[model samples]
Target: MSEVAVRMRLLQQSFDAFDESAAARLGLNRTDLRCLDLILAKDPMAAGELTTAAKLSPAATTTAIDRLERAGFVTRSRDAANRRRVLVAATEAARAAEREVYGPLGEAGTSALRRYGEEQLAVIIDFLETARRVQEEQTARLKKLPVRE
Candidate 1:
């Protein structure tokens, strides 16, 4: 692999480690942290949308939301435009915590990206999107794989 590819892999691994530590610090399992992240990333996101993004069943998603709710990390509401639909929104507390933990990293990323021109940034975006799709496919395949005894 090229140096860029190797650097990307290392960066990804480092980010995963950061998530693991953050989850532990927040007293959440990785899945719960991931669910919380989805909510925080997309404020006022629909409940079903979160389930789809998290690849969780409706029941499991409910449980995860309940946990976050109990922790005052998120709130659930009936959508005004669609009363039948539930919406998930991150609490100020949660968003504040996220900012506290991730703001510096986000700033650093912005600084790094400033060095790239539009064309280079487009290539980076394309690479990231393609990689994300591949990871999604692989995760789904792994979910369907039979366990060995």
Candidate 2:
């Protein structure tokens, strides 16, 4: 595999391990925890936006939101301007849960970045921004493609 692919795989493995360990501690499944985290990160997102961000089908997103609401981790409200629109937001409990779960991981990442000098850190940030742009372009391209056998 290419170096980028290898690095991405390693990063994904590390993230999955971290998430699984945290999920066990929180007594929640990885998916449930992820949904809560996303809600915490971006409050009052429409149900459709949640489905797109979570890469889940509409039905799965609805079920996930239902579970989160029942667990008191999130709440759903109708948009004041658009009553037909449903928005989901994280509860205070969910914010606390995120801090408890990901605070250490964030600290570790920050420490690693600090290990690099300012110039190196700047380069790393530029590379990450470029990667983000490239990923967005690729996603748009893929969305435009027709299904194939």
Candidate 3:
């Protein structure tokens, strides 16, 4: 494998491990916690948009939303513009839960970033931007391809 592939795999593993540990602490599976995290970041999204953003299949997204709604962590309503569309929004309970779970992790990450000098931070940001652009381009290319199966 190439160096970039090796690095990407390592980063993905590290992220998965951290997310699993955090989810366990909060009594949630990784998917459940991730759904909550996205809703917390940008609420009032249509169900289809949530499915796309969460990278989940339509059925899986609906299931996740159902679970969250049952747990009182989110609410769903018909979009005023389109009654056929359902919009999902986080409840206060969900926001508070997210803060409780992620606040410490955010603080620690911020502290680590703070250890870098301005030039080092700029380099890090530039690398991240490059990675983001690469991923976006790959996604666009893949999306244009017809399904082989």
Candidate 4:
């Protein structure tokens, strides 16, 4: 692999480690954390939407939501437009926790990026977006494959 590819792999590994640590610190499993992240990104998100975004089965998504609700990270409510539909939203506690855990990292990242010019930042942004798209595409492809147990 090229140096860039190796660096990208290392970056992914580091992110995975960070996610694991963050979830543990918040008293949550990785799946629950991932669900919480989706909820935070789209506050008051539909439960079904969360299930799709998290790539979880309905039952698994329910369990994750239950765990998050119990941990004060998320809450479930009936959607106003459709009483039968459920929505999940991050709680104030979850927001506070996120700020406590990720605020420093965000600040550091901003500081690091300050040295880069606009064009350099644009290139970086493009690379990250492309990487994210590739990851999403790969995840969908894997989900299509048969289970290998």
Model 2: per-residue lDDT, tens digit, 1-149? 49988997798699799889987887778887888778777897899888998889999999999988888888999999999989999888888878887888889889878889989989988978987898789999998999898
Model 4 pairs in collision: none
TM-score each candidate.
Answer: 0.80, 0.78, 0.79, 0.92
Tens digits of per-residue lDDT for model 4 on 34-65?
A: 99888988998999999899989999999999
Error of 1 at 56 (Å): 0.8
- lDDT tens string, model 1, 52-91? 9999999999999999999889999999999999999999
RMSD of each candidate? 2.5, 2.9, 3.1, 1.5
Question: Residue 76 in candidate 3 has what lDDT?
Answer: 96
| Cα-based RMSD of candidate 1 | 2.5
Q: Count of backbone clashes for each model?
A: 0, 0, 0, 0
Q: Which parts of model 2 are misplaced by more than 4 Å?
A: 1-8, 130-149
Which scores better on lDDT, 2 or 4?
4
lDDT of each: 0.91, 0.86, 0.87, 0.93
Leading candidate by lDDT:
4
Cand. 3 Cα-lDDT: 0.87
Clashing pairs in 2: none
